[model samples]
Target: MPNNMTAVFLPGNKQVDVRAVLVPEPGPDEVLVEIKASCICRSDLSLYYGNAVISGGDSNQFVCGHEPAGTVVKVGEAVTEFAEGDNVAVYLAVGCGVCHHCRVGIHYLCAKWKCLGFTMDGGNAEFLRVPARNLLKTPKGMSHLAAAISTDAFGTLFSACRKVGVNGLSTIGIWGLGPMGAAGTLAAKAMGGRVVALDPIAERREFAESLGADLVLDPTAPNALDQVREFSGGEGLSGAIDCSGQTAAHNMALDAAAPMARIALVGENRETTIKTSDHMIRKQLTVFGSWYFSIDEYADILALIKSHKIDLERLATHTFDLKEAETAFRMFDNRETEKAVFVR
Candidate 1:
């Protein structure tokens, strides 16, 4: 292997370039992973559009990527659980294990938690050095592309469902049809919850239906909330998840949720707002802001995949060579694919 490798970067809006950089070395508690596949997430697009909270200013020139799966090439002396040649999925949130939140298994809430690809160099390159604590063992049968999303997409969805008290036989309303939303549908279905998916795009709605949605509705259609209500026996939904992060979807989620139901907001929308008096107080709803997954939930998600309960293979729609990252990003930006992956 070469001493250095090329990685793609978005210096500004619509400006993506591949540049050569030195490969990272593992520290005492880190592991060096030779990236196999890295998936492009909506948050990456947000960074490209200058909308993400973590930003690398124009002068800083950051490496852009987050969701990645790869083989461990080297292990730090302090890392005992993982060794060289182990296939793994990389967790973006690297938290200080000694922190109060980390001690409670809430790594996402760790004050010093720093995300890969955003606050640090990420897996858009040939290799990356990540804290060993952030690595999850990839199941034997899973592909690199499928494993790439375990940390963000599947993990996050699982966390959201758990927060909302989802279980077999519960009715769920999903407010977006993107990759995460589609994953939610599958997850809810795996747990025996019937899903009602809502999206503006016809293609997304169709995708949701193919993924086992009990009902797929256009959020913009007249009586969309009525459709959701009808599906839930007119008592509203048992729980709702807002994956679109749009004002319309957020409002619709509030309308669809049953009294005292949980609503998980996974999307990032700046202009969205909910009236505290309109439904929050009247219905006594429980709202949760899902940031990411806790390390404890990763084990459950992995078990579901290993046992064939959740199918992630169908979620990856496009794959590109590392050199074609710009094209992949453009396709993702255009909404031409569900999940775009960079395969090394």
Candidate 2:
């Protein structure tokens, strides 16, 4: 094992750098992963711009890649379940083991929740030391890139759609055809839902179509909402997922939903206006703010991916070597790529 390794760091103000650092040693209940791939998420923008959405956005103190997958290279004495050389994807949210949320496997909701790349060092490096319990064993044939992305992109969308009761008979509207929106499109289609994907960008709309979205529309169009209504046969959407944090997209999703429809807001947004009566009360609609999935759900999620033959690897429009962190992040931030990943 190397005594030192190179890792990425964001010094705020859109600065990105790679630095030489010591390879982390596994602590009690921890395992050191030789990262094969780490994905750059849209949320990483907060860290890049110097105003992170997470409470403790200490850019200088932590490596900044949360969606990571790699092979285990070292394990602490207490880590018995996961042996060295096991391929695994990391679950970013760490919690106090005794908390009710952690007990229920929803680590992200724990009162003392601390996320990788936010509160702790993450996988934008050659190696990462994570708690063994956070390890999700990858299927035998899963690619490192797919495992990395599945950790959040596909996994979160799958959880969101499942929560909304998406099924073969459902017509689901997905707002914001970014990586998350594209992921929502894939998940909905795999689950047999008729998908209506909306985005202002022609490229994103086309990407969604390629992912099997039944309908793709420009949300900025004057008759977009009307189009959604008409597309759903004037019955309104059976379910809707807003993957864009934009207020307009949120409004469109709520307004286009049918009575008794289920809506899941998967996008991270600070604020958005809502028409309480007309969008919710009058329609008897159910709206949920869905975040990351419970740790236990990974099994079912992977199973669904296997059963549906989802090509998660195809979602990555670009992949960069670790040295190209700047270029990778720059292009991703500029919306030049659908999904981008860092490879060792």
Candidate 3:
């Protein structure tokens, strides 16, 4: 193994610094992974703009990439479930293991949560050292790129769709056809839901359509909700997911859903107004928030990808080497690409 490696850091104000640093050594319960692929996320822009989304995200001293997949090259002495030569993907949340949430594998909800790429050194580098419990085993034949996207992008939406009970009989509406909404289209379709993807951008709508969304509409159009109702056979949407974080989208999803239908809020909006008896009480809806999938759900996610032959790489519109971190983040920040990845 090399004594030193290249890592990327976002020191706020859109600065991306690629530096040479020593390869990290694993702690007693950690593992050192030789990173093969690492994906950029929209939330990473918060760190770029200096208004970090997660707490301590503005402290750009650490490596900056949470969505990473690679091979285990070295294992700490206490690591038992994984070893050298095992293919894996890194999960983002690092929590206090003894917490009630962590015991059940929902580490992100723990009180002492420290996200990768935000609070600590993450994968935008040659190697990533993380706790053994945070490693997800990727299936054979799955490319590192796919494995990386399967984390925060595809995996997050997949878990949300599962929560919404997307299935053969569902006609779900997904607001905002960005990367997350686009991934929702793939996951919803794979699970047999007829997806009605919405976005103001023509290109994003077309992308969602290409991803097999049953229908795509411009949410800004006056007849957008009408189209959704028409498409759903006049029964209203069976379920809905708001990935845009827009107040209008949230309200639309809440008001357009059928009675007893599930609604998932996957977007990162700070606050929005909601009608008590109108959108919720009258519809008898089941509203919930979904972040990353549980550790227990990783196996099912992999199986769903394999069985459905989901083309996760399609979302990775661009790929770059670690040295090109600046260009990659620039394009991604300007919305010039969907999923931008750093690959070895």
TM-score of 3: 0.97
lDDT by residue for model 3 (119-168), tens: 99988999999999999999889999999999999999999999999999
lDDT of 2 by residue, 1-344 (tens): 99999899887899998999999889989999999999999988888888887867578889988999999999999888999889999999999978899999999999998898878898899999998999999999999999998989999999999999999999999998888999899999999999999999998898889889999999999999999999999999999999998888888888899999999998889888999999889999998899889999999889989999999988899999889999998999898987899987
Report lDDT per candidate. Answer: 0.85, 0.91, 0.91
Cα shift from native, residue 149, model 1 (Å) = 2.0
lDDT of 2 at 4: 94
> What TM-score number comes out for model 2?
0.98
Residue 332 alpha-carbon offset, candidate 2, angstroms: 1.1
Instruction: Give Cα distance to truth, residue 278, candidate 2, Å.
Output: 1.3
Tens-digit lDDT track of model 1 for 268-325: 7766778788679999999878867877788898887666556787888988998887
After the best TM-score superposition of candidate 3, give how far the Cα of residue 344 lies from its true spot, in angstroms. 1.0
TM-score of every prediction relative to native: 0.96, 0.98, 0.97
By TM-score, the better pick of 1 and 2 is 2
